[model samples]
Target chain A: MKASLTLGKVTNFLGLGFFITLKDLFTGKLEKEEFKNFLRKTIVPLVSILLFIGLWHLGAKSLYNIEAKFKIEKALQDQGQVAADALKTCMVSGESSCQPNTLPSPSQVWNSFQSLLRDHNIISADKAAFIEKTAAMNEKRVAAGKAAIVYTGRPSFVDQVFTSLQTVFAGFLLALLIAVPLGIFIGLSPNLKSAFNWFIQIFKPVSPVVWYLLVFMIVKTLLIGSTEDSSFTISFISVGLCSMWATLVNTAMGVSTVDKDYINVAKVLKLGTFQKIFKVVLPSSLPLIFTGLKITLSVAWMVLIAIELLAQSPGLGLFVWEEFQNGANDSNAKIIVAMFAIGIIGFLLDRLMLMIQNWVSFDKTDAI
Target chain B: MAYLELNNICKTYGQSDGETEVLSNINLKIEEGEFVAIVGFTGSGKTTLVNLINGLIKPTSGTVLFKGEPVDGTSHERGVIFQNYSLLPWLTVGQNVFMAVKEAFPKKNKKELHEIVANYVEMVSLTPAINKRPNELSGGMRQRVAVARALAMKPEMIIMDEPLGALDALTRGNLQDEILNIWGKDKRTALLITNDVDEGIYMADRIIPLRPGPNATLGPEFKIDLERPRDKTEMNDNPNFKKTRNEIIEYLMDIGNERKSEAKEEYILPDLVPKDFVNQFKFGR
Candidate 1:
């Protein structure tokens, strides 16, 4: 009985109740109905994923063959039958340059992912060695009042990912700082709401490219002779401007809809204006504010790539653009790898926001 | 001068031609340390009157004077317990009560404030769940916390608007007794707005009915002569309780029936029936 109790606790803690159900079914301790549910939840999805990959592989193969045939035919028409035959032989032998530039196979994308990992490992080792070798030198320079020499090597894939995360977080903070207070002020009075409505409507739908350009134009003049690189500032600011509308709108909506009874309570307490906002207004509207924040974070992340690419910042967006331009045999595979990484990271960020929203919001009607 | 007075108060919603007059010609005076309950049916502008007294809202054309001073806005002296338990969902019961006490007694140190919060929370028998959020508690428990919060402020006048209407019978009975017990200790000025006639008769020195509305106004007041420390079980057998209850209920019934009869309209049915339906009925098809 104690063991079963502990198992139940563990199931609740880790959301692993299904695994126990599966174990029970396999051990003949489950009912037929329970076993069927296990299959429906767990097994069907696995089969569907395999089916998806199989279709992708077939499609990739057909596209490769079509391109290869087209290349050979063009060679024959341009030169001679001998040249066509030589090109076919090169393609059949799987020479790197002769490979058709098209949608990469699943295995090729997997290999590219592994290669990127290996490159990150190598670059990390290089960085560690360089730091060690220059530790004494850097110290000497500091003592002599001279600048320290730093590593000038290109950032690895993992470094780029971290840079992107840092930029997105900065952007998300910026958006929250600008939107929430403005939204509250607008929500408090009808006059303010009407006055600001036109501004928000006009700017909310502006594209990321235009926002980036606007930031760039202003930041360039503002940072005049400063030696610091301003791409990070520009990229994050543009991201913030592009993504803040959802948070602003949702916060205003939430604040305006607070229950009248709660307002009355605040009034009867004789709370000051700021106290009313902090104690009564903010707490009541937090669920909607969090929903807005979730949307803002996702939008920040989506616009971050384009802004980074435009600013030429060292992040995933720049990395993807560079890979596309490099035109190497494995570049397509590497780009596909980055695409998957971006999708998975976006999903993870959303879940993180959801977890935070649940923690702060007193509404428990929905668990997740 | 009375402790609280409302003079020729009128309240309306909307503008000009589209106006809805919720309350009209409302005037009342309550002496210091008097307990009064205003009973009305739902949507009879009982809340508007309460809001006017507490200074959460202003009357369109009349005066609300508290302690002979014009009521301009809300004050800690008039603590209101709203119908819906407006406990901030994010804050625990201890924190909700603590915030009010802190606001009411800003000069009091943190220790004194905490003591007050703890005392009231214990008064409502919610000491075990002081750290619980409103969502975690039952409806009755939430209302109890709201009570604890309002009373902890040490308001001179406690204004309650149908606070126990949403609760079931057992919780309501328990809360009514608890409120009475607290009021018995010090006869603070209190006003309760409710739809329940019995609740008014049991709790107050005087019971006043708010007539039903298009422009609802105050009806005649019923004076309750029940003795102090009123017993709930004994209340069922008391002659005065039955008489007052019957009188209030009958007056309300008369108001309802009068309104219905006035609204009763005659409708003449169209003098034609469908030819096919008539033929089918005659042939019994």
Candidate 2:
């Protein structure tokens, strides 16, 4: 009886093991297929980037003399050390004394990030207490820093990224608000179209920097007056004006490109204004409109970065500028890393916009 | 009173150097439930006449009365099937038909609307491909969808502008039969624009020839006077069908010969003009 019971237990264990292995195999197959698709989409781009990095590293190592190469390697090593020391000190003593002049390496930034995550309460505690003490102080700060980047001198890469993203989105949204209806008006009526044609022709070729400057000046004169900190106002105005042009041009073109047959169909049906736009015009023009939007979004991103760099606003552009200004010492390697991070973030932002365009795009077969 | 009337219609295009005329003195009265076929050669203003009736374009001098009212623009009362198969590419066959049905019967419940569309689609034998888009469909299928869409509306008048002109011989025969079968049941007032004499004889109560241009006009109307439900093979044997087909073909052949002579005269003009100028001027000198 004892032997039989033991044998039965052993068989059950084996069965369970087999079942677990089967489940794992199924899951592994699914994951592998998904990963393969992902790789198919990204492999060419990844290989190209790796090749570029390899070439860059090779050039730096081989083209430069031994001493020059050593200097760069030592600087990079020093940056790593600084990051480790800063992280160690922050963890041990609950404070950071790292200077802004010295750029932090990847490891240093990671360490700082880990420390910030741990001590989030410490940063917010004083503010919470201050808010309880004086509500007016919170309002003043909120108003002042609402548009500005609310970062300490030692801001994380995420803070910079989030700030830039917020600015770009805000400007893009504002551009859409201004452009779409105007575009429709222009597209529908000959009089409106003729009136706007000259304006479009004149303004379309104008540079974004020119638009930025003009808008900045106008906003300053009209609303804010001469203020020491006009960074936020200037950044918003410049980005908004620059991005708005693309959306306006695209929206008008999209609406105009709608099939004439659809218009006749609308007339035959006697669809109401709203119904006509929603049912006929909008669907027909969707492909063009989405393409326009893609172009507009990319332009908005580029404009936001330009404005941030030029205006000294808080964003990845500003972060890059600050790192570059800190000199060709140990921080140069950190600046290069920041450049890579910026590129990756921009690529991701473009892809996100592409996904959105895909989501909203009318199925090609559905077009009348 | 005529269900639709065209009184002394005329259309002239330009004023000066490049003056062109499309149609002149077109007069016709279509009774309710009458099927009329207007046959013409290419660029013979067959389309122009239909467009005037559909109110896509207006005559330079005349009026079109629909049910005792002036026809202004496109309406649900008159459904037009264009030669190009204007089935909204984005919509499926069912949806294309449903769109017309929905517009015509806005108050209809979903079930009623679906039934009406399905009935029309099935009438054209497109039930299997009802969910397919125009692009997904064959040319014949797409044209059938267009036909189904028109018929589903249950319009007072159906205007077909060479709707099956693009189809192959087999598909054309099939669609022609399908259209005739559908028309036989309801007897809706239909004006078919086609170049095919056999098609006119098979489908229409009366066949009218549109003469070739520099201002095309309607030739003498020929009444089919044959029995209902025309069979393609049997109609060939029918004496009336043969007589009418031959008469129409002979008339077209005469016009074709006249056009060729005119083209020959045009080619000969340049050479003769120089010789005539030299003789006249030299004699005067």
Candidate 3:
């Protein structure tokens, strides 16, 4: 009886009871208390999110209208008759005023998302028609052993997302290729670590913008005589350089601090140098290396926007910059839409890395 | 010729200020198929001696010979069961054993390798947990995996460094019997390092006491002439067991007393005088 009681307590402590309650609720056998608890758990977060959106809807209107109007009036009130006429037009027409440009409410952002999707559909149709018209000519060119003409239309919102993903992954791959071996080398030899330490320290904290400029200079020179696009290469290289430090530092630390016992085991087993590293050192240090990779990936993503914008690479960053420059009434709303898209994608990327980390790591609890 | 030999082995650790000698003038020889146990206190450098035998570490000055050849780097011929379970955490129990088997017998087919791993894992009675990783295992279970991994490698000699030190008494006894059972067949040359005197006598053909360190060395060896398949219950009443136990205890006690006095001698306070000593003259040194 005591054992059963203890088991019951343990199960309850681990919240196994909550799952049982959920099962019963689904089966229409839940008791009053359990039903209430289930509803609280499920419905509360939803309700809170709705409440938050509602608050945002109200707050954005009041903040944008009054603040933007005040700024415009204060700036233009001292000018002249022309300024007075412009101010009158701005105050009379909501879209003509600066308020809509400053802060777009939830409804406006939602409308902008819908319009962007519509624009994407139209552009996609146009691209399809262009491809169909060019198919015969392109086929003839292919038969003649010449390259076909490529589509040169402006990328849509969705296309920009794909471009951003491509850039970040390319950059992350390059970082991994460079950092892991360099880290292992530095970690294995104290002399090498000391030799590289000054370089790492000097360059690790250099801003992504500076890295972009440096990469842009080199890539521009390399591509000056070539007709191919250099923006993608420049942006990716900059992203890779900017994010390489995290992986390098973490990998080195991981390799250097591997448990001495594991190394001793490798010795006793008489494992070859290659076998020892691949079978022991790498596996043991994987958790730290993975942590570094996750950080590197996120950093690569965070700076990819700035890199893309500066380099004029086709990505979400460029989309945001273009919209900001457009400064139309709906441009502000579209930019807001892009911001949320970036945030959501960033969150999903992190989750993807976490999933992979958990899958590979033996110590699953320590993955995060 | 002895299967393994350690001649005048000495090890010193260099500190920032000075060198602290851990083991000095250590000499031992184990004949073929002999089970030897070295018993010592926690700080008596038992692990250092084990490392020396396993070729994991080099003695500051001396020679370690295996079958008349001087020990250099580690070789697959000498298998070690570490005090801490050194089974790779990422590898499953079967995979852990398989890794060693693969290394030792690289020419073996995949099926043959799997059989070797399965056989060892079964020997340790961890067949059910073949797929489970190290972190999922209990402490005792993990050590059993380590044991299986080391044994599966089929080394000519085995070195166990406090293999059961962290286990509960019942688990320790269980593993001790398991080791002895494995040792009975073919009786490969083996060395067991332990702090437990009873355990040393119970498992080994001969029990050698290692004196506490700061230049610690082997004291004496006691031979256990008990019959095969010794039962713990019967050993309690056996005269030979009693005699061996008492002899080891007495020798260890003598070393403890000697070390205690040496420590006491080193604890002498420094003599110093300050201008304010007159104020506390009653307590002045």
Best by lDDT: 1
Instruction: Give the Cα error of residue B280 in candidate 3, in Å.
Output: 31
Ranking by TM-score: 1, 3, 2
TM-score of 2: 0.76
Candidate 3 lDDT, tens digit per residue, B1-285?
Answer: 789999999998896579988999999999989999999999889998988888888999999999999999888898899999888888888888988899899999999999999999999999999999898999999999999998999888889999999999999999999999898876898999999998988899999999989798998799999887889899989998999999999999988898778665555677875678566787875
Off by over 4 Å in 1: A1-41, A189-191, A366-368, B268-285
By the DockQ metric, which is better: model 2 or model 3? 3
Model 3 chain A poorest ten-residue lDDT run = A8-17
Q: Which ten-residue region of model 2 chain A has the weakest summed lDDT?
A: A12-21
**Model 2 residue A328 lDDT?**
39
TM-score of chain B of each: 0.93, 0.89, 0.91
Arrange candidates by DockQ, descending: 1, 3, 2
Report the C-alpha lDDT of model 2 over B188-272, residue by residue, as the tens digit: 8999999998889889999999998768988899999888877788888988888989999999899889888877544344434
Q: Considering lDDT, which of the candidate structures 1 and 3 is the better prediction for this target?
A: 1
Q: For candidate 1, list the clashing residue pairs, or say none.
A: none
